[model samples]
Target: MAEGQEKPKRLYQVWKGSNRFFCRGRLIFGPDVSSLITTIILIGGPAVSFCIKVNHTINVNKKDGKDSNYWYIVLFVAALLTCLDILFLLMTASRDPGIIPRNTKPPESEEGFDMNTPSMEWINDRTPHLRLPKTKEVIVNGHPVNVKYCDTCMLYRPPRASHCSICNNCVQKFDHHCPWVGQCIGLRNYRFFYMFISTSTILCLYVFGFSWVHIAQNKEGILKAMRKDILSDVLIVYCFITVWFVGGLTIFHFYLICTNQTTYENFRYRYDKKENPYHKGIGRNLVEVFLSKIPPSMNNFRAVVCEDDMVAEAPSADHVRTSKEKIDIEMGDKFSESNGISLPEILQNLHYDDLEGNSKDKERSVDFDIHPSPFVFELGKRDELVIAHETENIHQV
Candidate 1:
């Protein structure tokens, strides 16, 4: 509250996920972002070696009265691809991956439950538990799908949404947690993730193909040429090995994009066995994945929020029951003193059969006169009190 004191910390500072923020929460990265260092070294190191080898080849060719313009073009293209791949990697890792906001408490609405059909069971002396089903059926694409409730997030996950255990947050259209980029591949960043892998594959092949060409320019045999430039030999081997990994990933993701399937769903659900609910035609699927507008992030990581308001602890069942008991006791005492009849006597004398019969008969005759009281109306509003009293009697037995 002091005028000279610093402002409260932003939401990113107090964020629950295992994510790091930079530029005052303008940029976000997963906890494993250090893995990107290895990725950069693998891609950058090979590209740099390729450029050096090409430059040396160009110099040798120029001295032999040959045109070295072709080598210059190769070098330029290699450098451009390397830069583009790095940009894609950064875009994939540094941006939000469509994280869904967490709920402070379980939803209290009756939309998902059939309250009219009660499956109540009396177990010994304890109150009947009003259990809610874990999975709710939702209609998606004209087919019924079961959406599970997440206890940690306190919500039913939307279609294609899943919780990433590493990030400790629910992500929309979650693909998988990619350790290479140190981020979750989800709706917001999957496009850049695909681009990063595809570009890396191209860059690796470029270096691999050019390094061999640099060696072949020698007048000697292939073995002799490789021996002369050891760096080019190393780059050829490195690129050859790396291409398999990145190239395979690129091809796999291309299939995923065409079929409108996430890596998570493809492996777990195995849509190959059954009809894919999400699949449209190939053209429409590609447009949905790549050309669709990405949804905005749900969290404002840099926004200022009150410290007290930030901690929304859900009340326990026992705590709620205790509070309700206190209210019932207080209301009962007040009602008993105002009206001559005690609360228990009024409840005992109330006959549901008589009330039902009176409703059926238009000109009904009553044996006893009924007086409408504000306390009776107040008691009618507290239905939980009757349940609590019945539970107490059961316990006494």
Candidate 2:
């Protein structure tokens, strides 16, 4: 690929090894099950347990011996049902539904050359369902080609997506790959990912509250319950440990969500020099994260979520503009208060005597978006000269 030209998408053969025998996506099952297990404990387990207690109480009040036993059966059945539901979801989430035709419409482009031929296919053929990595081979085209690879898709990965080794699979839309999820939390599963997090939090809260009730109720009967040492009572102890674990994590994640930061970012960007674009403080973060306030006026989602194939494609003027504008906005602002905002924290932590690099420009815009950045932070005060330097770096790069 030439400078400023799109890289052609390459094709690759799908790994034909017995997918079921070894590891296709089946290998990921461990992590998948881990996520589901957490979700089940955090989501359905408490809900069912609560229902069981209610039903058990009502049956006893009605003086119906058969009905009371029926409630116990109900508890067993509900537990079984929840387990089955999780199994079903796992199976479905694991399958590779063959590739659907790409309906990718290019953003309004000023550059010429219509590559949007309906017949062209950029994904894997064999495992249309699986993402196969592609490789390159030179071939002559009748006409001079602007790029061997499709501009929309980056380097030619075959059925597999060109996952940022960091994110792993070339997840669909590939929203910043999360290592914890153990899969690409992309467009296809974005809803599930969010649902998983949201539901997990709620389940934790419910389990935490519900466990307290059982702790109180069972405390009087703890020795009596231990007398039998039945598996059902064992589950209760497991539930108690689970309650504390999930409760702490869920509350921490809630704080992160309200601030529009992922757990990944919480540690990942702690020492970074640039500011996070998504952050808007606790109140604004909560509003946007929970309420889905996708700032109509500030639609910057595209910067991070274009197709995996499209990353490193020549960034459009609009993207450049968005990036430039964001940098300008950052540079224009003053890092005033001493709150927990990441940029300010980074700035505040720096000491003039401890710094060595150029510290002349303190008014430059600070952007945390660029990778392999050259524009240095104000180790002392490079901020002034940094924004324009960033704007230039972005446009030229």
Best by lDDT: 1
Question: Mind giving the per-residue lDDT tens digits that candidate 1 earns over 192-226?
Answer: 99999999999989898888887887778898988
For all the candidates, what are their Cα RMSDs to the real structure?
A: 17.0, 18.4
> Which candidate leads in TM-score?
1
Could you tell me every candidate's TM-score relative to the true structure?
0.73, 0.39
What's the lDDT for candidate 1?
Answer: 0.64
Q: Which stretches of candidate 1 lie over 4 Å from their true place?
A: 1-6, 108-131, 311-397
| Angstrom error at residue 6, model 1 | 6.8
Q: Pairs clashing in candidate 1?
A: none
Clashes of each: 0, 31
lDDT of 2 by residue, 1-397 (tens): 5799654432111211111212422332213334645555554655565566646555664784434564455455545545554554454344321111111222122211223232122232211231211112211111110111222222222111223333222222233443345344432343345545444444444444444444444545766644543433544565567656545665766766565554444654521664444456788656544454221111111122223433222324432223322221111122222222222122223222212233434454222221111111222232221221111111110
